[model samples]
Target: MSDFATNARLATAALRDLFDPTPLQRNDHLSAQYDAEIWLKREDLAPVRSYKIRGAVNAMRKVRATNPAQQVFVCASAGNHAQGVAYACRHFGVQGTIFMPVTTPQQKIEKTRVFGGDSVDIVLTGDYFDQTLAAAQNFCTDQNAHFLSPFDDPDVIEGQASVAVEMLEQLGRAPDLVVLPVGGGGLASGVTAYMRAESPKTQFRFVEPVGGASLTAALAHDGPTTISRVNSFVDGAAVARLGVCTYDFLKWVDPAHVLLAPEDRICVTMLEMLNVEGIVLEPAGALSVDVLPELSDQIRGKAVVCVTSGGNFDFERLPEVKERAQRYSGLKKYFILRMPQRPGALREFLMMLGPDDDIARFEYLKKSARNFGSVLIGIETKSADNFRQLFDNMGKAGFSFRDITADEALAEFLV
Candidate 1:
């Protein structure tokens, strides 16, 4: 076996001391939908509810072994990595400090605190992650503490490879394909590297959030590079830049194998899993599953595995998730309706509504013309077809309406 494959097995053995291997369960819903055998590597079931704990724990163990006196660990993160590090610090009885952006949600901060307890200290720093990272590094330098990188370090990468080792052992044989979600590329790089050496025939397809396609960017530039803007909705995988160590391992990946998943569309997958399978997945965790429909043809009659990388979803975002799902599925819409200045005009418009349609928002947007006033209307219905029927009826009634659901400027200000 290759050195990476050997080391990965050793890492997996070491992880058995920390936590049992995460489940590799076949998903009937996905299997039936894709007309193939679909298995999920449930990293979400880990103690910290993420695969990150593996890397964090493994890195800490290796560092403590080599350095002997390096008892302090530090990291900067706003999500899973922070929780992973905190959980490790407590488990190892080591002193650890974590820096987080001030804008991080209260729920995340609370979870980190609960996991670390007295073993770790939480530092609320800059508004942006870059500033927080700089602060953490500077503190590490002054305190002579070991900085546990979220993805860029070699030990962390090796630790992540344990996921692949466990997968091979659990599945018995290599699957035809594995779908991995990418952030800074730690997990994807680690899994791919080990699989390439140990299971040469296992094909891989990578998924990244559309707003933060760092892996694709790195492949394009042949190195790690920062993006101008990144939408942080997929907080777990929305990385602005790929990691240097990770990108070096992944630079050879075919750009065509990388798929960009739209941020809003992920909401539909999250809801589907939650409602249909009684499984709750954070946006980033659902990435691999979200791309199933896109890869349905490629995976048909084959065996596939999807790594669900995290489940640290905050229930507070449920309403927003449902809203995005509704919007993406075309079940809700916003539009402007021009109403005549007559008194009964509103009543006449109400009568044209479809049975399944409900008015979610209605406001008079006065137009400059004295003869007519514009009304901003938001509608929620059972099906997209309901909107078509409502539009047809309005057209026949001589009422002019414009769909502003997709108008960025209008929807932002009004919807």
Candidate 2:
């Protein structure tokens, strides 16, 4: 075996002491939908509810083995990585100091604390993740402690390869295609490297959030480069830049195989999995599955595996998710209407709505002229064609309106 295969196998064996291998189950729903043998590697079911635990455990274990006196570890994360490090620290009986952004959710903070118990300290410092990460690194250097990078380190990448080890072992044979979600590139690079060594014939596809496609940017630029802006809605996979170490491993990937998933469209997939398959996936976790439709022709009659990265979803965000899903599917719309300042005008508009059409929001913005007023309206209907019919009816009735559903700035401000 090559050095990478040996190390990856050893890492996988060590992970057995932490938690059982995550399930690799054939998904009937997806299989039928795409006419392919579809399987899901449920990394979401890991002890930390993510594959992050594998990297954390392996990295910490190797560090301790090399230097027995290194007892302190530090890391910065706002979600899964924080919990993974905390759990690993508790398991090894070592002290850990975790730094998180002040804007992190309370639920994540509490979960990290619970996992570490008395073995870790949580520090809420910066408003942004970059600020928190900088503070943590400075602290680690000042105290002469080891800093665990979320995905940039070699040990962490090798540890993450454990996922591919378990995947092949569970499936018993090489899958035709493996679809992976890419963020900082830890999981993708690790799995791709290991698979390339073990099953050279296997093909790979990578998915990234459209607004935070760092891997795509790296491949285009021939190196890791920072993106100016990132949409954090898919918080798990929304990285501004690909890590130098990870990019090196993934630099040879084909640009065509890297799929970009729109943030709103991912919400539609999340809702579908939750409602149909009884699977709860966070936005980032749904990335691989979200692009499956686009690959329908390519994936037909083949065996495919999608890595469901994590299920650390907060139910409080359900409403926002539903709204985005509806908007993306064209079942919901928002518009500003010019309403005549006359008696019974409201009733006239209300009568124009079809049976399936429901008013989700209505507000009179201003009565600027003596004969007309501005009104904001949000409508939800059963189909996109309903909006077309409604608009046609309104136009015939002398109603003028501007659709703001696709206008990000206007929708953010008014809706």
lDDT, each prediction: 0.93, 0.95
lDDT of 2 at 399: 94
Q: Write one digit per residue (lDDT tens) for candidate 2, span 210-313.
A: 99999999999999989999999999999999999999999989999999999999999999999999998989899989999999999999999999999999
List, residue by residue over 311-352, the lDDT tens digit for candidate 1.
999999999899889889999998999888888988999999
RMSD list, candidates in order: 1.4, 0.7
Find the number of clashing residue pairs for candidate 2: 0
TM-score attained by model 1: 0.97
Superposed model 1: Cα runs more than 4 Å off: 367-369
How far does residue 380 in candidate 2 sit from its true spot (Å)?
0.6
